[model samples]
Target: MPSHGAWLKVGGAMARVIHVFRHPDRFVSGTVGEPGERTFYLQASSESKQVSVTLEKQQLTVLSERLTSLLEEVASRFDTEVPPSAPEELTDTDPLDVPVEEEFRVGTMGLGWDAESSSVVIELLAITEGEVDENIVLDDTEEGPDAVRVFLSPAHARAFAERAERVINAGRKPCPLCDEPLDPEGHICPRQNGFLRDNPFTEG
Candidate 1:
């Protein structure tokens, strides 16, 4: 997706805010597991606070793609080049760290850029249970919805954009016929009219 050339604000003010981390030094998405069992995570950190949230494969894919487009727009508008940086290759790597607890499953997301700070802002909104009260108002000092706000420098954002794409594409290979992920055991290819397809690339 191409950038909209404008930042879009998402979510309403009524939801209960959970956590917000601003100007985080680190924000990256990673996954754990084999093929179908993979669990995606979006982790962020600063000097004092750290946050990690679980997200679905689809959400991760969208976030990565949108960030890429947003960065492209910023580069064009500012006539600046976004340099390539390898975040995963950096040493002193902060471990996903304790309290890697899943704060909330991300349901929706928003992105923007702060020209003053030359940083990209990404917001992850929570998945709420039950119907939300549209009229609910949060106190000025109160944190709203189980959300996470992160600020990423252009270079870091570029790094994340690259890393996210890598993680997302590392999933199981898809069936050539149907374009659906192939299971390790076997798969009934829809294009083959339910013919069982064995893993030709792996030993049975």
Candidate 2:
């Protein structure tokens, strides 16, 4: 079993620490807290090692959308047989794993398809106060920010994206007129000149 954490050395100094899950048993996106106040997370586990990283809701949404698009491109360009949707049996709806201690806040994410393994590779780098090096986003460089790397099968990738979409939509209802999230009390629609309007789409 690989260590839960691995450190790299750069120029006689400690470099970034990376957690790599070559064949994760499970990987999914989840959240903690209520709809409007949710904190999104991406969790991956294999055997005894479980890692969770925090990201913005919009980031998760983009990741899900890009995963689908990447699969489509793979199928079209490489003649790969990618599933149109995740298999029902593999659908995961469980909450985030226990002890969801965030290792880091993700600042940069990288996604790619590994042809040799026929897997989707997702890399998440820790947020830095300064600008990030573009090469470190995906490359295995000794000097870079901490990162979590998970390689998923096409089926698992599809499942992850599907679950992510569901989690994102489970948030607060959006205002029909302005497309903004509606408060529990009601939404003041800017489009309607700050007038409070009842959202027909949301059930009372």
Candidate 3:
């Protein structure tokens, strides 16, 4: 996948913590058993009393680093559910330069999701080495410290994508881009850009 671009915004205030993962573009949505095959949205939380924030790679790195402590126990409780892929390596390139539709995995690893902490715990085993592709972006940014974003292993990423798909799918959400009532596939909101939302309650 190529690191295309995305835009996320929050219209309502509810949870104090909301993490967003943004990428450039991709050929598929995320799933549980396997990591996504391409690069896409990878943004982090939007705290600090601001409804939103544009995260560079560094902020994303710091955010990911902070999550390590939050994931310890989850890994222990649900070790069986995680899968194995590859590890992510540091690079001198920028992630945005990568395409969104490429396939990349970190290493042979697994991921366990903890509902309590709302994080995925990663267990890196030595058996499998890390894997990424030519498009994986890791670079510096002048907006803050440096622009670079890291990711969970391919297996773990697959797990997260699966969970994200379920969670995002389950929500009674209108499309972020279209504002239409989202259904099984997705929504088509006219208010979003010009498409009409098919409201189950309202008849056309």
lDDT of 3 by residue, 86-170 (tens): 2233111222222232222222223345354343433221112345222312211111111213234334444334433433333
lDDT winner, 1 or 3: 1
User: Ranking by lDDT, best first?
Assistant: 2, 1, 3
Backbone clash tally for model 3? 45
Per-residue error for 31 in candidate 3, Å, reads: 18
Highest lDDT model number: 2
TM-score of candidate 1 relative to the true fold:
0.65
lDDT of 2: 0.85
Kindly give the stretch of ten consecutive residues in candidate 1 with the minimal lDDT sum.
1-10
Model 1 over residues 1-204: C-alpha lDDT tens digits? Answer: 112111223454354444545556668887766665778889887777677889888788788888888888888898566765544554223435665778778866778787766788887767776543333221112333456777667778888787777677667677888977666678899899998998554311
For every model in order, what is the number of clashing pairs?
A: 7, 0, 45
Model 2 over residues 23-72: C-alpha lDDT tens digits? 69899999998755788999999999999999998899899999999988
RMSD of each: 8.7, 5.2, 19.0
State the C-alpha lDDT per candidate: 0.67, 0.85, 0.31
